[model samples]
Target: MDSFSHAFIIAIPLLLAGNAVLVPFAVIGAVIPDIDGVFFLFPDDEPSRYIFTHGGITHSIAGASLLSLVAFIGLYLLSGISWFSRFFPEGVTMMAGLAILAGAMLHILIDYLAYPGIPLFWPFSTEKFTLGIFPGPSLMILILSLGLLTLILTGRAGVRHYKTYLILCLVIFFIYAGIALYANTETEGRAIPTMDPTRWITIVETDECFVVRPYDILYGRGEEISYRKYTNITPDELAGIARLPQVQRLCYHSYIVTAERRGDTVILRDPLREEKVFRYPLDHSSLVIPLQETRSGPLPKNTDRP
Candidate 1:
């Protein structure tokens, strides 16, 4: 989810509950996990850079907890200052900290439920877990959230009606999710949601190739648009390529990668980049390494190479 959507979605309930003190803190916490986005500003040429990239440690459970704790300590210390103490009493710091922690957790949960999930157990585990039911930066949700925010700001919808508006928003959100879930049912492989709630993209992996296709909840599956064939490179060669720092980073970030041979080099890239259906802002560039024929004997029979 985008920062605004994260803040507004979390803030709405707090507003309804009338916890004004914790609202700002919680909003801060919700958007702070995205601090890792700064990594995107620089070139992603170095493997070490991926450690700080989006959906990395900052999006993990341990990282979020540490951030919340640091934030709590900061708030606690600030409350001791005379000027700050007048406005933010020391007694409320603990509660505010808890609210911030909850907000951060909520942010992780939202991302986990969306397509191309975060590394929730990062450092310990790099595997991403996602329900793939919601598209990140969902247009529908963003528009609805903005509309609700406008109503609140304009005084057209006050605190008394917050519950009504919130409930309505949730219903619409869930309805879209339900549609996505229905479309994803019995999917061949990973079902990735697109901006359109009714539309999805499926990536099915085979021993020989990776099949990419478009799917729609209302129209059923579409024709195959991409078929990325596995390279004829031997397993030993593949293992060596995987050991390279750059390739390791690429594999860590991309869920479905394809290998292709170009002359004396082998290129590895995420197959999703070939299609326009579901475009994630992740690093989709190819990692090319020189082809090194390390073995002297014939290639393994399981490999597609002759």
Candidate 2:
């Protein structure tokens, strides 16, 4: 989910529980998982410092906990200050810690549902996991946001009445979640036969691709500023492609990785990391690597990746 989605999702409980004072802390906590991205301010894609400073550590489950603790302490301190007392309905309380923890946890869970996955049990394992619910943002966030807004505007979400809306919101989330997952499965089923994919279980579009966003199939093109297919690799060639260092690195960072062979060189790409080509969804400093795969094995062909 994006930060706005995270913010809205975290706001629900805070608003309904009549502790709207915690909403600010919760919203910040939801985005804390991505806070490390701040380092990206100074040439974020610098290979030497890339993984060490960004998503690598902060997106982890353990990272969220540590972030929550820090947030709790910060919120606790702010709760003590009398300056901001006028803003919060009841000022602040120690329970804001719980709100921060919940928001951060949801952030990790939401990311877990997407591709290239997250390192939840980092240090213990580097394995990634994902439900692939949708390649981009999920619809659950939008529905909840709209519904919550409607209730708030109609004056139906007062202290006692807000609980009813909250319950409805959760029900709507579960239903939409089921439909979204099912829709992805359906799209994958259709794409496999039509796309003529290299992998049996999945289909990686060539040249052009469509993503499974909330309620629609979104058309996407690489950052060529125009759509172009730069490479094409045969099925038998994938083994050699996977062994390439660039492909491995791309796979490590992406939830969905695909390949294309450009004559003598192999091109490894992550459709989820489309920004390397399109620059949307915030680039995250991705680089496309070209590979020279031979019958013996794969070798790095590009001395310049960045």
Model 1, span 1-306: residue lDDT tens: 778778877787898777877788898789889888887778876785565778778999999988888887887787778888776643446678888899999999888877667777777866667777677666766776677778878879776566765677688668867876677674677677777777777877677676777887777888985555566664455655554556656666565667777788888776564443435544544677786833233222211000
Models 1 onward score TM values of 0.85, 0.56
> RMSDs, each prediction?
4.9, 8.6
Kindly list the per-residue Cα lDDT of model 2 for residues 1-306, writing each as its tens digit.
667667766776777666677788788789899887676567644433434445556778888899999877776667576775555556456667777888899898877765445667765754555554434354655565666668778887655544655576567556545645544465532121111111112333343443322223333222222222233755455555544443444545543444566556655555544744222335432344444433345432211111
Residue 55, candidate 1: Cα error in Å is 2.7
Model 1 — TM-score against the truth?
Answer: 0.85
Worst 10 residues of 1 by lDDT: 297-306
